[model samples]
Target: MRRMKVEQAAQVIDRPVYKAALIDFLYQLADDELFLGHRDSEWLGLAPDIEEDVAFSSIAQDEVGHATLFYHLLSELGEGKADDLAYSRPAAVRRNARLVERANGDWAYTIVRHLVYDIFEDVRLEALASSSYAPLAHGAVKIRREERYHLLHMETWFTRLGQAGGEAKARVERAVAAVWDDLGDLFSLGVHEAHIVAEGILPVARDELVQRWEARMKPLFEAAQLAWPGAPHPAKEDGRLGQHSADLDALLETMGEVYRIDPHARW
Candidate 1:
């Protein structure tokens, strides 16, 4: 079946369902990156090594940059100004998965969590790269290019830490379990999934994305000499529907404080 193509913001404006789905979908992408970037940034001064500190800082910048890209798309669709969209939304309105909002626990936890997320992102971008929505497809191509490097970096850490023996291996295994337990509805397409798929804004459904993620992770688990956790359970709270936790509220307060303080400031 051929999906309808939406080439411009003008095109989206005329289609109510597609427009609404796109807006919801963009929020999911933007909010996930915004909070995940903040989490990654917290590692800036805290990573065990100076190299990792610099690396995480760069990754944090990239994630936030990616979020702004999505926010810009939402702004084009009249959601609001990009900065306003990024900084002003309350936690109850956010659409990020729970995984992105969790605190960074240990280096082991961070590495496992990052690798799992990067794989999911890679699978998602691969699907989005072919989206019938032209603007989104173009952006996915560029963003996926950068994300692949991130995946590779996390994979390196995952394997090295796992193979280092004793405490490193134990911690890696423990972190993997913790991350696995937290993986709930991480790839959900939200309430607008059917509309998004019908318009070809996102090519795959949530289930396929999760399946791809699991397939990608299996070998990484084997290479790392760790047991693969089975499929994740559906979360009780659906973040896609704007349900989040206490952590998200605190993170948002900090992320938007500067903007809240000086709404008129250029930056």
Candidate 2:
């Protein structure tokens, strides 16, 4: 029985090819959310303002929840339990782009990542809402529902900080420029683009997704009075592609310390 009601509908591709694509796509989704969430969690009591702190905490939790959903999907594919897959992956094997692995840098940078990543994610999920694969299609629909809150939160801060002027404006501007270069790969298909599309899992092409993201972000940039910085850098066909940063390695070690000790032991 179909678990989700098919909505609008998308073109069907190939299945076997899509399975691997699905895995790759989900890995990017889960790993990015997990790493970003971990970094954000460190700021729990460190935020500058009480209200802002609470808001950041909520954003962190949402990222973790997003990761959990993707990990569960991976588990259904025989990868392992969601927790195991999430906490046990080797750093070098992680597929999250370098952008997410970098530290929050500053309140400005953190917000920058939140806005850029969240907006791009919104576009991607909206596109995926029509995924041909039943599971992904359904999951995308559910995720999109919660994502509205994220966008709203980020947009509020983005406008406040961007227009606040002086220190705040300078900080946000610097933050936006800092990560603009590395932000490109966040939309990359790596080597799975054709596979995913060929399998009819996702409706649109990866480039198409990038274009849509750029279009969606253009108005926000204008509203903030931020200038377009041209196209972001593409992944260098390693690490994110198959190559990863040292940060990921250390993250794995820390996250896995307890789990690896007694895989069968209940927490």
lDDT winner: 1
Candidate 1 regions off by >4 Å?
Answer: none
Q: Please list the C-alpha lDDT of all candidates, in the order they appear.
A: 0.88, 0.76
**Number of the top TM-score candidate:** 1
For model 1, what is the alpha-carbon lDDT of residue 255?
A: 78
TM-score of 2: 0.88
Task: Give the per-residue lDDT of model 2 (tens digit) for 1-267.
Answer: 122232321322233455677788889888888988877886889998988788778878988898998898787776889888788777766888777887777888888888888888888888777666677778888888888998888788787887778898888888888878677678776678776665555667778878887887777777777776666677664445857666667767776788888888876
| Colliding residue pairs in candidate 1 | none
Model 2 bad stretches (over 4 Å): 1-15, 237-239
Model 2 scores a C-alpha lDDT of 0.76
In angstroms, the error of model 2 at 85 is 0.8
